[model samples]
Structures are given as structure tokens and as C-alpha cells.
Target chain A: MIEDKNQQRTNLSELGEFGLIKHLTKNFEINQPSTFKGIGDDAAVLDFKDKKAVISTDLLIEGVHFDLAYMPLKHLGYKSVVVNLSDIYAMNAKPTQITVSVAVSNRFPLEALEELFDGITLAAKEYTIDVIGGDTTSSQKGLIISITAIGEAEESELVYRNGAKSNDLLVVTGDIGSAYMGLQVLEREKQVFQVNPNNQPDLDAYTYIIERQLKPEARKDIRTLLHALEVKPTSMIDISDGLSSEIIHICKQSEVGCNLYEDKLPLDPQLINVCEEFNIDSTTVAINGGEDYELLFTISMDDYDKIKGNPNFTVIGHMTPESEGIHLVTRANTKIPLKARGWNALNG
Target chain B: MIEDKNQQRTNLSELGEFGLIKHLTKNFEINQPSTFKGIGDDAAVLDFKDKKAVISTDLLIEGVHFDLAYMPLKHLGYKSVVVNLSDIYAMNAKPTQITVSVAVSNRFPLEALEELFDGITLAAKEYTIDVIGGDTTSSQKGLIISITAIGEAEESELVYRNGAKSNDLLVVTGDIGSAYMGLQVLEREKQVFQVNPNNQPDLDAYTYIIERQLKPEARKDIRTLLHALEVKPTSMIDISDGLSSEIIHICKQSEVGCNLYEDKLPLDPQLINVCEEFNIDSTTVAINGGEDYELLFTISMDDYDKIKGNPNFTVIGHMTPESEGIHLVTRANTKIPLKARGWNALNG
Candidate 1:
């Protein structure tokens, strides 16, 4: 479904390794005070002063992580960076710099790479993070993107996944399940178009969910809001592999059980409607759906008053004793054990 | 030419993502004081205090960067980590942590991955670095490795490639051209084996150069030796892409020209023998052939006494004014303009 535009294609070999890297990263401006030198050298240098540096990396492979049929090159680049930044935010750290390494086959043109860099630059500008250093190389097959994000935070402000107490409240920022439903919509349209090539599917109604899949933003605001309210989370994680999987990670690390209230699970109206239209359960989609770059955290009981009625967060669960086990209380009053059916690439 | 042995093949899907990561990295001990947390977290937290963080990343594709016909999986993993560490050492920094992201097709078994991780863990131990974090996913083709190395150094001790003066002396650690010759030997053996499958090529004489190609070490000792002698380099870079290409980078970035003495270029005895056997010029091999992983740097005239006649280093060139242009002065008293004929992946 991805049409190769019959444009002037410039071979990547015209520009050597150094020339290609320079051409792609020429417009990235260094705005972070922590960054001393960015690109052009053997490595990027950063002076973090007294702040603790946090580093996270993610690898996205073509065919496995994304299909080019529906995913635009620019949005793929933006989402690749966002995915790594979300990990840094999960650590309660402010991302300062990122190094992007991409390997592409010869089928791609110079113009395609330029479009990818355009999206990368846009994300760097929006996040106020400097593009520090990266490697550009040739692949034998499809494209592979590996991004490493570097961030900083004071020792006192840093949160880990092993600090939740038994009575702490579990909270999540923004809505869930939209990104997964968005993927379903796009996939369905792809199959439909495969059978009928001239079909012009109306995608206006799926704009919000599709955007969630294509250009999801890392929760950079939650860190600021928690700081403004003087409430530090006891434990935190990014909902990348779905809410159930992330909850299991937090619980396994913190040595506590949780009771997630199904009725309190936040969902966008569009997502609810899409699930019904597709004959899928909204709760199952919300619990098992992946690629939702939202922040999930647990705060102590004393900090509940500060966040109780806050619109930026929803208290969906509470940590219980380890013996209680992890369960989800259905709206019908039956409690069932939660399962982490998150997307696993290795399973394929 | 790579043979798949009929052995116990454990499918990757049986372990899942987290289980596989944990199984692979369980033996990685956090020995660096700067690494506050390693693995099992959203991001690895590092405390470098006042030291500047030096970051470098490299991407290696299977067929484009390496061939599995002669290169073993374990050696590939070891070389991947060493390559990134070379960049960190080029900046005159001490590497403390590394994140390794690997993408492989389903053909590889768990045992094969364990062998690769064995080499990675060995390099981590030898270099005194912690395996902080990484991402493992499925690839559509052969293996792809992306490694990011993090190091630290004081502001005064850190070196850049743009600090060389007109009168600075260029120095390189260890002999060059061995890795390149090693590849030639392997390729020759591979060709012979392809023609006659049972041809047993004697490789005892090529052990040194073969090891240089298979398991190269970054110049970790060079930083310590310079620190002990109190001689800081004005400019530094690793010799991953041959001496001539690296010299061009230093001269161009430093806004100076270089006159490299052909007779003074270091060469291993084995490399010289192999070059003669192949009927190739040793000097050409040393200048144009790549992947040596040595440290090439420049020092001020005042510090020449500290480095002169040092067995570990060789002073092969001196910097000139920018208008002079980079050149190589041969033993025959002919000056030839230098060209960066480094390895270019996109050329394929």
C-alpha cells in the first residue's frame, strides 16, 4: 500500500558517510545547557553538574515494529524518539539529549531520509532536547532505528519502580486503548484497500485514535505538575506494553499487590465507540493494548488530597498487601486476576 | 557458507521478552560506582558528579558491516562493544556503562544468543563497564547491533578533535593495518572453502592479525597512561577507519594541514608479511584499509618529551597551517595529497 513516488531519486552513495550524516543533522540546533558538544566529533560531551544522568534505549525494526504501508516515515521517526523519551519520563527525569542510530537499505532515497530527519528535528524542537550524536549506516534488509535518550534529575526528585508502599494509590495520566484501536483501524483499512484498490476510505472519524498511534506524546507535563503540587510519586512507569503489563512490573518490583477498578479505567469516547463498532470489549482493549505512551505512578496515602480531584490524573487502583495478589474488580462486582497480555515481538 | 548445526534449538518465543532479557543480562554485575542502577528499570541512573558524560553510539548490520561466513557470533558481540568503546576512548574519557540493543531473526536460537551475550559480558568485564540497559527485539533479516557507550572525564582532561595546533605532533597507539589484513586472510580462506569445501587453510601465522579483526580492544590503557604521564592530547580520535581517513578528520576539524611521514607509520610484522603475500603495498594497506581500533591523537610540542620513544606510541606526523593542505611525505621524498578512502557502507 506504500506507493513509491516517481521522483528524482538520489543515491546515498553520492554522499559518503560523513557527508550523509552532515546533510541529515545540519539543522539540529543544540539548546540544552547540559550538552557541551553535539555531533561532528567522535562522541557528544555533556556536563550534567550535580544531576544524576538517566539513559534509556529502544530498537524498532521494520516489519516487526512497524509496517511502512500505513506508517509515514516522518511519524515513525517522531514516535521512535517519543518512545525512548517516555522511558526517561517514567523515571521522573527531564530528557536533555538523544542519540539516534539508523540503518537503512539502498531501496530508500535521500529524499526519504530527509523526511525522516524532518520529523526527528521537529520532535527535538517540541521536547526541547538536543540531538547529540548518532550513527548512520547501510542495512541489508529493511530500516532499523535505535534511539538512546539521556536525561537528568536531582537525586531527591528521582523516582524508581521499587518504592510503592502497600497503601499507595495507583494513578495514570491521559487515556489508554486509543493507540491500539488506532492500529486496528489502520490495519482494517489496509486489508480493505488490498481487496479494492480504488476504495477511498474516510478516515476523518478515526483522526484522534490514529494520531495517538502515529504521534503520541511522552507525558512531560506530569513531572512538572507533580512538582508544582509538591507530591513525589513513590513509584512510576510508562505504559508502553499496556497497563496490565506495567502494573505487573511495578508490583513485581515493589513487592505489592494491586486492585484495579474496571469502572475507573479511563478511556476516550472515540476509543469506546470504536471498540463497540468493532465488537471488542473496551476494558480488554484498554488493559491489553500497547503503544500508549502515558505515565503510570503510585503516590503515598498522604499525597492523595493533593491529586484526588485533579483532572490531569485518574486514580484507577490501589496497592494492597502482597498476599492479596493482583486483581481487577469488574464493574459487575466480580474480581478476576489480571494478566499481562502485552505485545511481545519475540513471540512471533 | 555458514553452517547450521543440527543441535538443540530453543525457540525465543518460549521465554518471552522480559524473561529473555533477564536471562541474558543476569550475570552483568554493576561494578562501576557511577552506575547507581543497572537494568531492571525504565532507565539506568548514573551519577558522574562533576565529570562530563561522553556518549557515543554505533550501528552494525549483518551483511553490510560484517559477514557471518567467517565471523563467529561471540566474536561479533565482542567487537560490537569494543567499537563503541573506541569512540569513548577517543574523547580521552573512561567508559563506565554501555547499552546494547540487538535485533535478530527467528532463526537464531537461545543458545546462539547466550553465546553472543557471553562475548558481550566478557568485554564488559575486561573494560570494567556495566551493562546498564538495552532493548532486544525481532528483526526481519539477520542480526543488527546498536550499542551506546557512556563515559566520564573532567572538563580539563576531556579532549576534542578540533584542538590541534599547527605545530602539534600526531601520535598513534599500537600498530595499524593488522585488522584489515586479517579480513583479507579470512576472505581468502572463505573463497578457498567455497571452491573446495574441505580445504583446510593453515592460520597459525595469521593469529595476531586475525585476533585484531575478531576481538579488538579499545585503548583503555592509553587514557590511564596519558593521565599518569600528565600529557593531555590537543586532539584525539580512534583509528576505526584507517590512519589517512582519521588524519584527514583531525586536520579538517582543527583547521590545519598534516604532513604524515610514510616511513614512520607503524605496522605489525604479521600484517607486513600478509601484505607481501597478497602482493599489495603495505603502506597503502595501512592508510586505506580500515577497522584497526587504535587511538590516533595530537599533542603540543612541549609534551613531546613525555611521549618520545614510548614503546606504546609512534609519532608519525606533524600539523601545518590550513593553507598547506594535508599530505603524505613518502620515503622517496614525494608529497602526495591525502584522501579519506575510509570504508563506506552506502557504497554497497
Candidate 2:
């Protein structure tokens, strides 16, 4: 549906498997000292020395996780890397290497894969991580991308989801719900395009929301920022599955209930406007929308003074005893029980 | 086509994504010292300490890599992890942890996934590795599995493909070609079964070959054996893409040539019988067949005496200067150039 007309198409058979891998990764630069060896061997060798290694993996399937109609190949590749790296950042670690495995059907031309790799290379460079190793092969149907990100952190610096305690302050980085709104806008435009392919979408007002959806950057600078502020999170998790779900995860693992303040929930101005345009509730979107890629974490109440007015962070709420149950305090001073309305890929 | 007639089926959406992951990996035991924290977090934390880390990843898509008509879910899961771990063993590292990501269509019931994870758990127990993390999601088509294996070894003990030198003796552990023949037997059976569903063809004679194809094991004991013999390989690689392709890889990377002895190519007795029955060349299958999961490496001449006469290994060739091209020295006193007929996943 999104095929580019006038573009050069090269059959994947022209390069074969090994030839394609070599051609795609030939320009990948290895700048990480931790990477003792990169691609070209059976496995990539890494030297973490005294530091701890943090590993995370994610799988992205076409039609299930993304639609090619609105999601460009390059954007899809970039998002894949960023999402995996977000998990590392959630652990307060510095991502050092990534292994990307892609399985594409014959329907995708060589140029399409080149575009995907170009995005991967760009993200690796931008994140200052080495593209260590990967596998590329054919699929029977649509494209599939699996990325494993490796990061390094000192043993003492790492955070886990079970460290939060009752009364800890809940803090989130940046805004939420923008990516979900961006997806909504894109979906609407896709339907409009289906009706009239000649119609050009003038999406100037949706610039921020669309960028949030298409090119959402991980909170790479938050680790340094938190360190500079002398604040270590008691527990942390990335907001990939919406605020309500992540809050539930932290609560369940940390054995604490939370009072998430609806008034304090960070929502992008663009997201608010888009929700109004779509006649959706901004608070519901902020709490239940997914793919914000923001950092939702808990810090000791003692550190709240240090981050009181920081623009990068929003003091969302505070943890409570498990018996209190998880709730969102609305602006009307009424508390409502929160439910995990996150995107469930398996439900699709 | 291979579905059980009376197997219990449970929808996956009933458990949701988080509950399904929790259920599938609840039985995984963490026994590795390197694994500090496993699942229940955004990323797994590993303490590699002073050891170097080896990482490798592979993606297996249904139909492209295996046919479910003959491949069981459990065996498929086991083979997927084994294949990836084989890459780590090829680097002379002991695999410690792995992250598995799977995407399956709604057609796959919860019972099928349980069977698949059961095999993953079994392989982890057999290999003594930790199933640290993974992702489970739905696909639009068939099943897709991506696994990244992490191993560790001392810097001095690690091996790479570029360490081979001229005059080094090439050796291979165990036998080759049986796995390819096993696949042939299974394919033929599948075809026959299609013609008559109730036909029960005897497969006793093809037991070993079928087992090799369906439930192959990686050479995890080779490293210990080589260490006990006090012989460090100059260069090493796993035979995942047939003998000739791996030889070419080592030769090209190490800047050396090889003279492989056709008569010395290791072949199982069952493979010979099967080749005779199928009217195929045993030598060709030995050199060109894939998925043997055996170790192919070169050791310096000084270590040859230490490894010679070992029943687990066979000296198949010797490295030569780059000026001499790679060739096969036949027992009939004829030198024929070697060609790589490795399975190309992208070709299909």
C-alpha cells in the first residue's frame, strides 16, 4: 500500500545471505571500547571488565506491531532500536552494543532493506553504541525485526523494579500519550488516504505528535541528569505499555500501592489538542496510551526537594501501602481505580 | 498437518501478554552466577566481572526455516536455542544466558506455546544456561523465534576465525551430514503421509538420522575436551552452514588456504547407509550439508600430537599458504577444488 513508485528495485537474490549482510554492515563503525570484536565472526566478543552487563530483547512483527502504510521502513528500524535501548536506559545503564536480526519476505526489495539498515546505522551512531552482530534471512510473509540491546552499568548503579518502598515519590520523565495520539492521527490519515490517494495530508499542527510516534527517542540523557541531581531511583520501568500498566508493574514488583495524580500526569500540549480534536478524554489518553517511551520511576521522598521544579521530570504521585490499592486522584478530588489499558500485542 | 487430534487448546488472550510471559517463564530456574537479575524487569542484569562476553543471535521463521508438518513445536524451540548456542561455543565460550523472543499467530493455542517453552526450558537445563529474558507476542502469520545467547570466557582462552595460520591442522568434532539426511527422511515421510493420513510407515531404520534433524544437540562438550587435551584451536567456527562454507570463512579471514581430504571427511555409518539407499553421494552430503552443530577448527602443528587418535575428533585437512587455493585431495590421487553448497535461508 505504501510502495514507492519511481524507486529502484533490486531483487534480494542478487546479493544472497552472506553477501547482503556484508554489504549492509560494511559501513558500521565500532567505537565502543567494550566491543572487543564486532560482526564477521560466529559471535561478537565484548569486554565488560568490572562493569555489569544489561541485556534486553524485543520482537517487532509487521501487521501486528506496525503497519507499513504509515510506518516507513526507516522509521520502523529506528523505532525498533530505540525501544530496545529504552529498556537499558530504564535500568540507568549506558547502551554499548546491539544485535539486530531481520527476517524479510521476497516481497521486500533490496532497497527497502537498505533503508531499514540505514536507520539502524543512524540509531547506533546516535546512541553511541556499536552494532555488534545480527542475522538476516528470508521470511515466508511480512518483515520481522528482533533486536537485542546490550548495555553496561556499575553494579551499584543498576536499578530494579522491586526496590520501591511505600511513600516513595513517583516521577516520570517528559510527557506521555503523545505517541498514542500520533498513532491515532496517522491511522485517521491512512483511512483518508485510502479514500483518496491523491489527497496530500497537511500535518503541520501534528508535527510534534507525529514525530513522537515515528521517531520517539529514548531517555538517554536521563541517567546523567539523575546522577547530576544526586538522585537514584528506588525502582524504575519504561513507559512502553502506557502509564497505568507500568505503574501496576512497579507496584506489583515493589509491593506498594500508588496514588497517581491525574492533575499531575504529564501530557503534551499537542496530545491534548489532538485528543480534543478526536473528542477523547485527555486524562484517559494520558493514563492508558502506550509507546510514550518515557521513564516512569520512583525516588525516595528525601530526593523530591532536589527535583522539585525540574522541567525534565514531573512529580506524578506517591506510593502507598498495598492495602490502599492503586488509584488515580482526579482533579475533582475523587479517586478512581486504575486499570491496565496497555496495548496487548497478543490480543491482535 | 501435524496437529494432534485430541490435544487440549486454550486461547492465549485469556492470560494477556504479561500473564502469558509470567506463566511461560515461571518455571525457569536461574543457576548462573553471571545472572544477577533475570525476568520480571525491563532488562536482565548480568555480572560478567573480569570475563569477556560473547553474544550471538538468530531468527527462525516458520516455513522459511522449518516445516511444521514434520517439525514439532518442542523440537523447534529446542533447535532454535541450540543453534544460537552453537555460535557461542564456536567462539570457545561457555554460554551462560539467553533471551528468547517469540511471535506466534492466534492459531497457536496456549498449549502449543507451553510445549515450545517446555523445550526451551529443557534445553536451558541441559546446557546449564539461564533463560534470562524473552518476549512473547502474536504474529500475523506463523511462529517466529529470535534468541540471543550470551556466553563468557577468559580473554586468553577465546578463539576467533582469524587466528588460523599456515601449517595448522584442521579438525572437526563428531560427524556431519546426518542432520541433512534426517531432514530428507522426514520430508519424504511428510509427503507420503499426505497421500494417506492413516498410513503408519516404519521409521525405525531412520531413527538416528531423524533425531539428528529434529532434535540435534550442539557440541557443548568440545571445549572441555579440547581443554583437557591442552590443545587450543588456532581458529574455530561451528558448522551451521556446511563444511566448505565454514572452511572458506576461516581461510578468507585467516589469510590461509586449505587442502581438505575427501576420504577423511567424517560421516556417520547411518548417513552412509542412507546415502546408498537414496542413491546420493555421501561425500557431497558430508561437505555440503548443513545443521550438523559440530565444531570445525584448526590447531597448530605442535598440538596435533596431543589431539591425534582422539575418537571424538577427526583430522580432515591442513591449512596452507594463501598462494595455494583450497582443494579437496581425493583418495584416488586427484585434487578437486571445493565448493560451498551451504543452505541459503534468503534464497527461499
Candidate 3:
């Protein structure tokens, strides 16, 4: 984190609520043809025509969902959009518009909000989405953000979490556990900085993991890639809460069971090295670590040949009958029952 | 507010996040045919087909938007949904679905949330809306609620705030200033109770005004009535931020000035009586007190004969050329420039 001690502070009340919203959103350009009207209206109008509309929402609160000690306002803004958009991609849809609402205390200045919106505008540009509408208000405590993402897709191309069959192959996109490890690294650095303000710790070795934690990208390209391969997933879900927890969701909703192979869980080399340095089990982190923003889905056994050598995909497991129950097949040929050890915000 | 001193308390972590969501939303039925899939997948699917979709969102924070001492959780839940739906109705659209997301601290028991959801369910039933999806998690401080309402309308029937033309009559639905007076009464009672816990003051006279504050209704019936009368509003907005602020929004966006008559401002009998008791100006409260949830719109002067003596509608003003500027015509035949003095949450 870069701290600027000489930054100028502008009071939010000087501009009022309307002036603040107008100033913050003045640079956001609407590029979606479906968004007939955006901002400046009581409600946004969208003409999805023949396509089906898909909607998802999330609420992120300070101290519970994130800590400002290590999280920059810009990255928090970018990651907030990514997390919501990840759900749209998990459903085989293209996101076209989003509504962003934020509540902050007077401890924040106008420049801080501008930096947050800069990241939002950047994400909207990168993902080709329109910033349709939002509400800005004051919080009695820390900052709170709520986002609602809207997307559209043809009826035939849509996917849900209840279509998996017994013989389907479970697949995961990209690597897992990297984001969780990145958070650990940041936490450690935060502790070090707290003990000694003059100490400047070198973070060159943690660049990748830290970036993964801060700027994790959503798998927006997976839908197009799967479309080109002619492989439509039977059941799909985003890996927001670790691999084992997501597998459980698919199995329970589809009325089937799954056997996940520990050896098949994709892990980046840096994540493995970091886990060793931290003296934590790599397999345990891979199975229970969350915030990967990757797609986890089950496809028909017949489609294995189509994705056999795809670098972006890893065949992690297979589905079984509902009577068998869910289990994890370790590399040592041991079967252990899987449990949902994903991060629980409420438990905190 | 009703307080149960010996109410049973169940820890939220006992059910976990998923179980808590399932238990809370189990009673929400999908009444709209447009909702293809709800609450079980990464996103909810809606088939709008050929009709245009209208979406609006709002964020409510404790201490800033409401006071828990004077507002019950159930009433809070119902009012949260009503505020969002009011925006959709302002566009002359039929609200069909809503997604509610809430963040609360662990101090709130599961039963407290159940009471909140009971209010939400009742509002959903009354408005014929489907609670499609939402996210529930922990907050670090007070409660936070975010809601997004989705509706549908034909292209010709949809309204915006920038469609008002010169010579259009400014019309308001029902009455105003009652909800604000209701809040004043509640606040006074709360203070009185704090000074003497055993004192139980009679509140029979303020029932209507109190209900106006606790459980305001959106204008869902106005659309059907307007359709039956073969009339469409030129421009429309909901009165959440009081009348003066809303009028400024219309005049600035539509590029038309307005002359609001002081004599024609709507005021209920209870609101007048309460204003006298509190020694506050009724006209000032009518124009600057927010959260009324009524519809304000502009209609062509030619349609004046169509709604001349209608009991539900009141014509308070008419639009003029932009050069004339916006003003309030007083009973003394004095023209004073209008200002936006509506409640600013951020300014708090």
C-alpha cells in the first residue's frame, strides 16, 4: 500500500449528494445497446428483446468481508465488480449492465471515492459493461458496498446447478488456492508493518500471489471457449467458496454424489512454494481456500475427448449416484468425507 | 415499536450462511411467470421476452436512513422494499420481482431477521412481487439493507424525468407531509419513554400518520387507473427526497420551469393537527420532509378536463418556459424562488 501523507482532502458535504454522484459518474460511458437508458433516470430501461435476463447481487461490508489495512480502495472497487460478474459468467451469460451502491462514513474524502470510481470505470471498460444506476449514502460506521449485476443469454444456452447426471465429468478452470495464499502473505506483511513503522519489508517474491489477492480476474472468456468447443456444461457454479464446497452444491442440487481427486486439483507453483514457506498443507488449502473466481461445472462423459488437453481446464473429478455420498479421493488411495470449510463471514 | 423482553434468541452461526438463507427465504413463492429460476443458482433467470425491463435499486443504512428505537425490524423490512418499488412505479412500470441483500452484526438473532423477513414477505404478497434472490452476511456495525426491484412495461407506456413539456400540469397522488409528521410523533414518544419508562402515553390520534411513516405504500394502482383513463404522464418521479428536491430534478432535467401554488399543496388532517401540536410549519414539512413514497408527475394541460375532480389526484402547479425559472407562488401573490432543502443523508 502506498500512503500519501500530503493528499488533499475535500469534504463530501461541500458538493452534496447529487453533486457527488454527478461528479463521480461523469466519466462512465454507456456502451450497451440493450441499456436504452442509464443513470439520470428513476430507473434504468433495458430491452433484452428475445434473450433471457440473469440477475445476481452481493453486499460487502468493511471489517467482515475486507480490511482496509491492506486493501486499497481501488482494488476493492475492482474486485467487487469482478465477484458479481463472475456469477454471470458461471451461468453462461454475457453481463451488459451493473448498478453500484456505496455507503461510507465522513472519515473518507471526495478523492477517495474518485479513486474507487476510477477502478469501477476501468472494470466497466475492460468488461464492456454499462454503469446503469446506483445510490450513494452515508454509513454510521465503515464503508459498505452493494452491487447488482444484470446479464442476458439465449434460453438454450443457459445453465443451472441442477442438471448434473451420475456419469458426468467434473471440471475446473484455472488454478485454485492462490488467492487465499495471497491473503495470508498480505496479512503477514501487515503484522510486520504494525510492529515497526520504519521497517520496509521486501515483497518482490510475493508479487504474483499478492496480485491474485488484490486484482483477481473473473473467467469471462470461459463461456466463449466452451462455446467454441461445443461443450455445454450440464450443471455450473462459480468457485466463490472453495472447491469442495462448490462440488457439494452441485451434487446436492443435482441429486448426485461426487468423488474429487486430491491429485487433480490444479495448483500454481508459486502457491505450493508459499504453502511450504507458511508450513500449511497445500492440499488442504487447495480444497478449502476460496475467492478463486473460477468456473466449476460438470459435463457429460462423452465430452471428455473435447477438453482432454485444454490448458485452461483440469478434470478434477466425476459424479456418482446419490446413494454413494460425496468424498475426496486422496493421492494415497484414501477416501475421506468432504466438509465445507470455506470462509464463513457470519462465524467471525 | 413492540419489544419482547423474554424473546427466544437463536445464534445465526448455528445455521450457517446457506442454511440461514434457505430458512429465511423458504416461504417466498415465485408468483411471476417471468421468473424462470430463483434462489438456487448463481443468478436468477427472468424471461422478459418482448417487453422492456425496468430496474431500480436503493440502499438503507441504520442511524442514517432510520432509527431502530422508533422503527420495528418488520416495518423496516417492508419499508425497504416499498422504497425501491416506488422508483419502478415512478416510471409507470409494473414491478414483478425484487432481490434483497442484507448485512447485520452477530448481535442480531435469527428471530430478529425472521421478523424482518415476515415484513418482507407480507410486502411481497401485497404487491404481487417475487423475492427472486438475495445475499445475507455479517456486518461489522449496524444493519444495512439493499434492494433492487425489476419491472416491465411497454415501450409507449414507460416514462422518464426529462419528458416534461411547457404548459404541462404538475399533479401529485394522494396526500403528503403525513409521514414526516408521523416520524416527529414517534421521536417525541421515544424521548418521553426514555424519560419515564412506566409512562404509557395514548397514541390513538396519530395512527394514520404513524402508519404512513412505518409502512408507506407504493403507487402500484395508479398505473392501472391511468391506463383505464387513457392517459400517460409526460414525466414522472417518486417523492422520496421530498417535493422541492424532486421538482428541481424534473425542472433541471426537462429544461422547464415550474410555478408551484402554495394553496394547492396537499395536506392531510392529521398532518395539520400534528404540525400545530409540534409548532412546525405545515407547508415547509410538506415540501422538505422526505420518505412520502407518493408519485409526482406532469400531464398536458389539454388533459385537465380528463382528471379535473378526481379524488386521487391534485394539480399543484404547471410548467413554464426555462427562462422563467422555478418559483413558489405564495398565498400573498408573492413569487419566491424555490430551493432544494430535502434531507441529505450524506450531510448527516
Q: Give the root-mean-square deviation of each candidate in angstroms.
A: 2.3, 2.2, 2.1
Task: State the lDDT at A126 in candidate 3.
Answer: 91
Tell me the deviation in Å of residue B232 in model 2.
0.2
Which window of ten consecutive residues has the lowest lDDT sum in model 2 chain A?
A339-348
Q: Per-residue lDDT tens digits of candidate 3, residues B167-253?
A: 999999999989988998999998898998888878899999999999999989999988888889999999998999999999999
TM-score of each: 0.97, 0.97, 0.98
| Chain A only: TM-score per candidate | 0.97, 0.97, 0.97
What CAPRI-style quality would you assign to candidate 3? Answer: high
Q: Give the docking tier of candidate 2.
A: high
Report the lDDT tens digits of candidate 3 across residue range A58-120: 999999888888888888889999999999999999999999999999999999898888888
Clashes by residue pair, model 2: none
Q: For candidate 2, what's the RMSD?
A: 2.2
How would you encode candidate 1's per-residue C-alpha lDDT over A1-348 as one tens digit per residue?
444463888899899788999999998999999999999899999999999999999999999999888888889889999999999999999999999998989998898898789889999999999999999999999889999999999999999999998989999999999999999999999999899988888988889999999889999999999999999999999999999999999999999999999999999999999999998889888988999999999999899999988998999999999889999999998998987873442123
Q: Model 2 off-target regions past 4 Å?
A: A1-6, A342-348, B1-6, B342-348
The superposed Cα distance between candidate 2 and the true structure at residue B220, in angstroms, equals 1.3
The residue pairs found clashing in candidate 3 are none
The DockQ values of the predictions, listed in order, are 0.92, 0.92, 0.92
- Number of colliding residue pairs in each model: 0, 0, 0
lDDT of 1 by residue, B1-348 (tens): 344353788999899889999999998999999999999889999999989999999999999889888888888889999999999999999999999999989988998888889889999999999999999999999988999999999999889999999999999999999999999999999999999988778999999999999889888999999999999999999989888999999999999999999999999999999999998788888887889999999999999999888999999999999999999999998998988983342122
